[model samples]
Target: MKNLRDEFPLIAKNKFAYLDSSATSQQPKCVLKAVDDYYKKSHANPHRGTYCLSVEATNAYDFSRQKVADFLNAHFEEIVFTKNATEALNLVAFSYGSFLKKGDHVLLSLMEHHSMIVPWQRACKTHGATLDYIKLNNNFELDLDDFEKQLRKKPKIVGISSVSNVLGTKNNVKQIIEMAHSVGAKVLVDISQSIAHEKFDVEKMDADFVVFSGHKMYAPMGVGVLFAKEELLEAMPPFLLGGDMIEYVYEQETTFAPLPQKFEAGTQNVGGAVGLKTAINFLEEIGFDKIKEIETELTKYARAELKKLKFVECYFTSNAKNHENVISFNLKGIHPHDVASILDSKGVFVRAGNHCAQPLLRSLGLNSTCRLSLSLYNTKQDIDKLVEALKYAYEMFFKTK
Candidate 1:
């Protein structure tokens, strides 16, 4: 596998083991340069000003949206930029979900991140709707039987994760979407974890809506994407009512702007969007085939090595074959925070917590676990360093016991 670590200035300089790609990916120099170049060359309020700089900014911002649409195989009008995936999901919950009435069921899975869960919970409360969850099987995978049973309840909408943030389980979202659609339920897929690692074609998948974060895919923070079918976007009301989203304003009533703009209510993160476009271009240059190959090899190697440690209690031990570069485990008798601190001392950075999936962790009877997530930039040598750090931590913590 080709090691492209030099492209990331942080990795190149610090040489730290970064195993938290699921949380947020490290930005490459090209993405940083893109953002910097945008600010340096064409920094202005897009879509509002008629000046040359503003026109250039608007054009660049629109081009970024087009680039994202092309990347997802969707129409440009279908993409709406937001602050993050959480905001995108909340947009659907507030706008589209407003149509839901009392007794309407909103089906979700146990594996959703808190970002996906909390918004719907609030939406359901506001709309007088009922929330339902699909259970996980013994393998920590979504129980398709329970999913079908829940679908039989005739849900109004389904919110599911394309990939679980903590478990690293790549769900069969296409199948789930089909099932939901059969019951006339619109499905919202949170692709925050899967967007960078896998191929996602919104049209091909026939997804009603999809949301992902730019930071998770090597772009800067403060830019996210909400992709919905044009018809659905047209039907849903705007989540935020503000300057850019208004077509006309009156003393008593105001008319909203077009499909995407209506949802994008304020001045956007133009530099962030430019960086996201650059990040997408970089991913395209590297290609998913290479990304998958590297991630698969690293995941397999890490899992194999982690399994060798008797003190490590892996969460999804049986279905690790389905894991995509994320490993969540706990050291027997050591708190995850302590484990993380020990690893940090050795310059091996990993996430230690519920990973914002408290419900999933609770289901597994765990309050917290240490997580090691990989990306195209990770290497087996990083895993070796992680293992060595784990051994050191184990000896330091347990030797006296």
Candidate 2:
């Protein structure tokens, strides 16, 4: 497990404990090398040229797509690459969302990230469709009763995150998908936070659409995955036009490319695709069970230690086992940014403020929070350092006052 930290070059060079893996993970050496090597040897505009370089680039990109497809138990054509998860969500919100009619409803939980929330909000607003949220219970978890009630409204589609970005609260996504389907609703599950911790089988999950970001799962930025059922992809129109996404173009009419290419409008990120492939290979080498073990242990230990801090108020569910990688807390009277700054001075890094989930925080009666997220590479010592730095921040604040 100690060897995992060494695999990430940036982690190796930095003495600080990088507890912000949820924002974006540090790239492993293999992923970086794969990206660098692809640019040096195989960079080309795929699907646009007949040259050998372009052919090689095309093969690499296709292979990466196939790899991701296999990883998700999805069809190769069902896998569309986007700039990031935000774009992938936007694609869905723009494309399939176009089918929405007046009075059609879209349901999401209160815990959704802004990427998931804003897109649906825009889509519903555009289509004269109603958008509403499932309420959260006292446990800081999504209320199943509220979810069922929302389903009663016959939402046309439902968007949900498998894990909360701020709270690390894992939802019963499989059950939700099943229920949503029974209501004749399509379901989109954002696995951006959960993908790094476990293996995924989209078919088994019965999800209509799934999205994730490469950067969240140890690959470089600029690559994201959108896995929709082939039927869904076929039914939805393309979100963007131009470049490789088109099959034919005339002065007055144009036909779009099929499957995955239809959503990928521009020159795709071949280098990032190369890196994403290597990142998957690297993670498989480490194995998901080991990754979960490391993160789960750290989470439990940190929860126990944090519980001892009276001045620190945690903003998560009471069930310690309910949360996974993210630990949202704040010094009782200090601003989150100030706490972050103090922690930074002591070589402990974390995310401050609303974590792009302002609505979720407001729902929790918090304006902001300091969030420390865990990764497989994180150790108990890292948690210890965070604890020390937090104590330092608390003391520095009240003692000075």
Candidate 3:
């Protein structure tokens, strides 16, 4: 397989050693040009006009929605586009929060991004429900035993991350879903970090909802997918009521559009969705399996090389069998921001701070962890640059002292 580095033109530019794919991925020319082409030639408001340009824009937008549905193995009607994963999650929280009662409970893990945790917390507060957090084991994997204990609590919604953005620990979502369902709790997966690395089948996972951002998959920012079971979407009320989501508005009563559009409200991110579809097509052409393999190799190389540094304390299981293509580690006697600054001086990019996963960071008893997240465009050579930068950083920070 020709790796993504060979396929993507941006890598050739040596713009920066980008290891922050967890933050957002570099867009391929195919996706970028798709957005440009849409604006340059076929720009118009979708579903609101009868002209040829409008029809073209509507078709392009609908095609992108269908592509996202197919990518998740979900029905097109179940997919709703939001500004980003945060908004996707907020929509669910706003709608479903109404269902909670005084004693109702919402379950989540410490590993979740704030996108997943904060919404539920606010929902619980508004709807009079309690929130429960699943603790991590010594290895930083969700402690199955702790999870089992929490299952007895039988929360109304069990929200979990498909992968930890900070630690790179992949969650056993299928097992978690099955377990949650057995307890009569619905599951919502925060898949922002996992969607690009592996397959996500909503039906197979039996999740009631799954939220993800487009940018993490090399799609444009400001577009995301919110997948809900059709019935759930139907049962939930409209998230935002406005012109498009309404069927008819009278002085007496108003009616709303069906499942997706009800939540979509105003004009959607038509161009972003088109770019997302193009990005998905690009990934499909490269084969997800190949991307996963390349990332796994890169992660393995990173873990092995980073472990050699005497000052480093690596997180995640060193086995590399269960981890994603990310590395989170701390250099002794140096703050993560300091380490990241030195690495940046070498043109190496990495993510620092809590990674919007404050609960997990608190659990680890640290203010922040330096993270290196890999993607298809990364190679072993990227890992080499990282290791070299780390050595220099360590010498400058620790050995000099």
* lDDT-sorted candidate list, best first: 1, 2, 3
Residue range 121-230, candidate 2, lDDT tens digits: 99999999999999899988999998998899999999999999999898989999999999999999999999999787998998999999999999999999999999
Q: Model 3: per-residue lDDT, tens digit, 46-105?
A: 989999999999999989999999988999899999999999899989897789999999
Q: Please, what is the TM-score per model?
A: 0.98, 0.99, 0.98
Native-to-model Cα distance after best TM-score fit, residue 19 in candidate 3, in Å: 0.6
lDDT of each: 0.92, 0.92, 0.89
- What are the per-residue Cα lDDT tens digits for candidate 1 across 221-243? 99999999999999998898889
Worst 10 residues of 3 by lDDT: 1-10
Pairs clashing within candidate 1: none
Evaluate model 2: give its TM-score: 0.99
Error of 2 at 165 (Å): 0.5
What's model 1's lDDT at 348? 97
| 258 Cα displacement, candidate 1 (Å) | 0.9
